[model samples]
Target: MTLQQAPETVRVTAAVEERMVTPSLSVQGVVSGAPTREVRFEGSAGGAKQIVTSVAVAQDASIAFGDLLATVSGVPVFLLPEGVPLYRDLRHGDSGPDVSAFQSLLTRLGYLRGSATGTVDARTLTATGLWYKAYGQKLPESEGKPYVAVDHFAAATGEGTVRLGPTVGQRLEPGKPLFVLSAGQQAVTARFTVPEADAVKVGTAVTVRASGGASFAGTIASIGPFQSNEASKEQRAGHDVRVELSLQDAAAPKEASTVSVTVGGQGRRGPAVPLSAIRQGSQGTYVTRELEGENSSGTPPTRDVTVAVLAQEGGWASIETNPELPPGAKVIVG
Candidate 1:
């Protein structure tokens, strides 16, 4: 008599899911700079011996046109209400592009009248007096005549927050950086090793999170050339690639601050399962499912199903199958 053996119960377990995911890469970076600049205050009056006697504005002060920045040799150096930098001194008789530009600014500001002739005459002096009076300063009459110091304004273009470069009781030499202006816009820079050079590209969207600060979004603006240097005694060689990011959000961390940069891996979603559920064999990568009904041999029947990997993250593999997988379909893990 042939004895029939009961079918052996085979048990396998696996975790499954149907969730959306986006691919990404994360790296470390630093805040490079702000959109504003640290412009140096040049000596005005085109003289070799200009000295600063007093500083008017405090650190983190908002600077504007006609605002007194410093008092040089008892002369108030006001912020000019113009965009272009003053490259030369303008007196009562100077004529050039600078004079024309100054004349035009004064004319537009209602401080001067008539066309800009690029020549400083009585009209220019009258305009200068009006400008000084408007700012509550005495009409500057150095050497017994109305004059505009070449470095008269000691101002920078663009209104923004200011950082004092020189302290009070300090002298501002000619062509020295007197203050730094924060323009409110900022950028971040991240460096990647040689192995990661190809992965970093310009225009790639990135999420930047500053240390102990709010998170912001940016795009890779530029990638610098490769550089190699000697490492340590044991590790001889190392390479690096520099990446600059232009941030869209204004509330950025301070410059030279460290931040985290995440880039790449976007636009993919599907059913996710344990990585073990994915099997690689002679046929290719696939998953298996045990048939509900048993074979004549009284054993569970199984079929191999092909699948394409969409993404892998956090021990889960997102996949696409030829035949759609049901929401709760059982997949073999081992």
Candidate 2:
């Protein structure tokens, strides 16, 4: 009689006893700077066409408080702290947040003493005159009274560099943006499918990889509403959600560039198995676990254990079984 042949042994991989598994979705993204506000010309040209006389800073130059932005028709345009637009001219005895913010600027420059009282007092006027003098400009005057003119300074929020919009010899229009102030911080923007949006949220950690193999840690700063593109014969309509990521302790690409972003979903700690090992059957999701001893047929014994998939990531799946699958358990993957 011929000897009975051993049954074929199936391929298997060890199930991770316990670990945190988090699913990650990769999507294309773009790097950009955070824009705070657009600096606009708020001065009335007094019926005369406002013309850019000279440019003090170049395009993409770093500007700060007390920095001259441009010269318009022989009047210097200085950059100042963000506040209510200097609608009307400010002079001694004017009291408001605008006046207070200006006074604070003067104090910071050592042109004014003590805290800003929100009132343009004698000291405030003196400081203003000194500030203009320091920049080689005469204090603007109307009716023989020295005052801060609306056209002399532009309001910019945040502390960062600015991008000049107006060039020398360009006509300046009141209420038109002259420059854009950026917060000097870099951020990444990307869109995710609607299904993936449910797993991603604000403050979710992500990995950003730029061209040339550079990578950085980032966090989800904001989530936008769902958007859909109009469907056409060539392409099917789809919905997606937008997300912005703030780079942490790293400089992003200077110019706008394409990047790859990997966003991780919430993690769960539990027993896990190779994603390939998970199978769906009549009883539901389950995995085939190999037994320790061989069966009477001389083949390895195995049984299917029903499991609830909690999370999956990186080729592994976290699962829950009735009888907890212990660490180092062998599971059939092939």
Candidate 3:
């Protein structure tokens, strides 16, 4: 009774404030086509009827540039680069960006000489003649060369899978779709409810987590407006939206493949502390700041400060608090 209680002692572990933070939202998504193209055999049978006498590659075969896709009436139909899918034939006086591209590619392939003037002039025909000769075919007497046929041997700008639509004995029709070629390029798509849609926007940076722990970086390319799906009862009851993402990385997730997507908001730079320092209270979330004793000599007292948690990631959070936290400020984490 005579002895007074020693000065109250408070012992606790804590973390210090370091820097700012950005928050993230994780969602489920599927790998889908940025756009799957149907590769059609646009070659004319030269006004003579021809049947698909024989088949070459099997269904779903992975084809590459210069690979022989099939044999059409004893003539080799090969997979070439993407540029050959021209809608109309390329001829002199037909000047456009497409012609320029064709000219450039022909020059690079050593099939043509002179600059790519963007106009299909005499040089284009010279290049065309050389290409036809190399491919064992003579230049057509027709005014325009079959640009689509040239695609048969032009370098494949995009690699794709073989989707054969025509079979042996099938009659070829002028301008009708033949076999389809899939480029196999893909993007990621995420679904969300009306409420969640408000938080997401195009141009938001995102990371897709693939199977086996692989992660790829991308950006939100589009956000679809809310629409009802009459096919599903649940979907019909709530507004649903789609978010399309464009991958910055080369490797694309397989078709119909599922992956995890982490969407992050525009990053902000500021002071941050360990997540443990944040506490949920009756009022809201808050953190305890340690105050220095007289002359900064002894154990310090602590005061609770209200804070608005903006974002939390990587074990830290970006917060809005009064009298912004100073570097090295001690905070009670536990």
Candidate 4:
């Protein structure tokens, strides 16, 4: 209808079915792991690869391995003891791919000047020896025997030679590493090193938030094995603790994003309301209540209402309308 050409009214009536109106808060936060873990591995050219350091378990406030050790380049990151570390059975086949993997690591670490194609070349082996010698690690000889840890990589010739230990400019052999290098060089942990001043008792409860607005309601299937406050939900940091939280259904996160964590905080129950819907009177605050609206079943109606002003924030107010109010009650806003 046009503003000036309004039609006469026809009265219509409907029923008001009582329904429950639940409200919640939408909090913005970053997710993180409350606990994490790591494992390390060792391998040589013609020897059985072993997990020398094994799985390093840190918990309760211990430092994680990722925060301490670095990974060897050109190797696949692996979770060992069950899953196979990358490049396992390399001794049985042509060494091309293996050489490529090694070269790939070398290229990443600024050691090799060629493409990461697995070919056992003279320069590659020499670079490999240089890497170990530089890092002060032990390496098997050309025949893959035991090992002599290299001390330094420079001779008195000033710039013409690269030493392989106490030996002056020992030449590197093909298909053999002068020093040991493996991708699974070390394992990492996901725990944070809590300060002694802030560290809680062993069984103290801690609250953790999830990344990208995850949830914490419903049945908690499990708690974390360790503790840390350093994990970021954005996955930006190189190392952080990870906590696994499972839910009964996928939809619980829709209700609320951040759960009010109660480590040792007092817990209580209170009525929640919108900040705008509330208003202050001489005695207290009040909210506006509508006498009519539509129901979830898709029928509109009206009923008696007493609006209680609970809270106010931003442009909105949390008001408590009549509990008997229908799902979609219309109210006059100020």
Candidate 5:
């Protein structure tokens, strides 16, 4: 609208500013494994339920070659990123959640018992033994102190004990669990090593190219404070950065579900505009300016200013102001 119709208190003007443009990179990543089948057994009578575990299907969700399988109650199990894929020989157990965290899930889900510290500890083993006993099978004592037999987890804690009957201590409510178990679910973010020429800071925005038929959007979650080139050439000069994409609301079909990930940091800087003159709107922004004399044009004269925001506090945008534009400039906003 023209400025003539603008209210007397309205300010307006055309704004010029800067915005950073980011480069896009292509990456190869995967969709963490999913449960194929679930086998659950009920105890014939006391004796503890024989909850032999295996996946309805078998998935070697192991990221490392020697990495062990994640299982519980005959359910082909889950995992988490054991380590940096590059350094750890490109393992994918870290489908999205942490496997160590899953050990805990098994305990809480009543599927397997014990502490879920990501490792197969005595608590986990004891829980397993109790589960086996419920199925009429006798489980030998664990090799360690409370007798832990789950060898995968060497760092066990507390003397693991079997809670044969329904957890005896107290009645617990569902949804209001005493502890949380990791489901092995994780949001995939693109990671890249920056060179001296491309080193970027944390919180930087990145424009991710949707490849492998999957479209995901996100920002720079972390830029390693320290630099390491032990993995990729890009790390030689710059640090390794992780970019996260919140796929919570993204529309992705199953076909591209497990697509590879590639990422690039927002190469350009954020928007830079003078906060003083901008009038925010529900959908967009407009500049309101006072009419020259009371008999000006009813339409607001707008510059269609490019808004590149840097920092804004209070009511002002820490931006470069237009010299020709006067202060208290009011424009017609309709």
Candidate 6:
């Protein structure tokens, strides 16, 4: 005549709809760019001290072929394309790689026609004169013919844009850099642990968050070889590898800026439930799913459904089961 015991009730939560589950890793990095070359004052100031009379370009300004960079000692300094340094003066009869490079610059500036012949011929001389005249300066002459002098222009070793170095009224010396010329596209570089290096590959998608709260998409451009740090009294020994990222449809900050990079792995979409809802027993991993209607005893019927865990991230487990667990299905989590 003992009273019948009531079944213990369990709390339940709904299984989320199928969605993409992706593992992510965040790292700190800095915006960077390709190698930079120094723009120097290759011209001479007679025997007088070379002084920057005026500066036409601002710092971090983008310069192009035949653009006036500055004026030194009343002489204009023009920006030339990357090539062999303008060493000796070039006259109409000069013939060599330097002359060829100069001719190429003239052609790019629309001052010369056709291809560069690698010789300072009549076309080259006339182009040089027009180039100087365009910038409001008279072309230097040698033997009664216009010629290119070393000091009238500064040649960069690479191209793209430039970061100006010198300022107005600053004394300049021959061979000293007037600016730093950027050679290629800007990028971001980050150091990653050995495990991270192994997990990621080139072309992996990533999101970059700048220090100013701007976020943009990027991709893994390159990965450098691993490097081990030497043990020092001031630092612990460790190993890391460098990873470079290229921005998409955006430009990095002009100066090197700190950024947060979130690298995401491949994603898998499937039915997902709370990690706590997954139960493991001798029968294998399963979840206690509540059935549709209550039984005659007035209690909700439940069944343990076996599941194959596909992926688990952020306290959520993506699973596969024989009978599809549709979205909003109630599952016992507590």
For this target, which candidate reaches the highest lDDT against the unseen true structure? 2
Q: What would the per-residue lDDT of candidate 1 be over residues 102-165, giving only the tens digit for each residue?
A: 8887887788889989888989888878888866677656678767765556666566667444
lDDT of each: 0.66, 0.72, 0.62, 0.33, 0.36, 0.71
lDDT of 3 at 254: 68
Q: Distance (Å) between predicted and true CA of 43, model 1? A: 3.0
What does candidate 5 score in Cα RMSD to the true structure? 19.2
lDDT of 3 at 318: 71
User: Residue 184 in model 1: shift from native, Å?
Assistant: 6.1
Model 1 Cα shift for residue 270 (angstroms):
5.6
* lDDT of model number 5: 0.36
CA lDDT of 284 in candidate 4?
35
Question: What tens digits encode model 6's per-residue C-alpha lDDT throughout 1-334?
Answer: 9999889865656665677765566777777765677775666746787889988787656777688888988888987765655678888778898888788878888899999898788878888889888877788876776778887887765555654467789998656788886665566777764434544677877887887788777777777765445544433222232334454223555447888888776777878877678775567567888788889978778888877766556767677644647777778885
RMSD of each: 10.8, 9.2, 11.9, 19.3, 19.2, 10.8
Q: Report, for all candidates in order, the number of backbone clashes.
A: 4, 1, 10, 21, 58, 1
Of candidates 6 and 3, the better by TM-score: 6
Q: Kindly report which residue stretches of model 3 are placed more than 4 angstroms away from their true locations once superposed.
A: 1-25, 38-49, 52-71, 76-110, 114-126, 136-176, 179-184, 191-258, 263-270, 273-311, 314-316, 319-334
Candidate 2, poorest ten consecutive residues by summed lDDT: 234-243
| Per-residue C-alpha lDDT of model 4 across residues 1-334, encoded as one tens digit per residue | 6568669554332222222222222222223322212232233344433222311222222221112122222222222221211343322123555456555655655667877555555666666556555544433453663322111110110111111111123333333322221111111113322211112233333443444444353211223333333565543222122222333223323322333322222322233333333434344334344444567744544333444433222333333435644445343333
lDDT ranking, best first: 2, 6, 1, 3, 5, 4
Scored by TM-score, the top model is: 6
* Model 1 worst lDDT run, 10 consecutive residues: 234-243
Could you tell me every candidate's TM-score relative to the true structure?
0.52, 0.57, 0.41, 0.30, 0.25, 0.58
Answer with 1 or 4, whichever has the higher TM-score.
1
Model 2: colliding residue pairs: 17-327
Superior candidate under lDDT, 5 versus 6: 6
How many pairs of residues collide in model 5? Answer: 58
Q: Which residue pairs come into collision in candidate 3? A: 19-271, 19-272, 20-270, 39-181, 80-156, 81-154, 81-155, 81-156, 81-157, 82-157
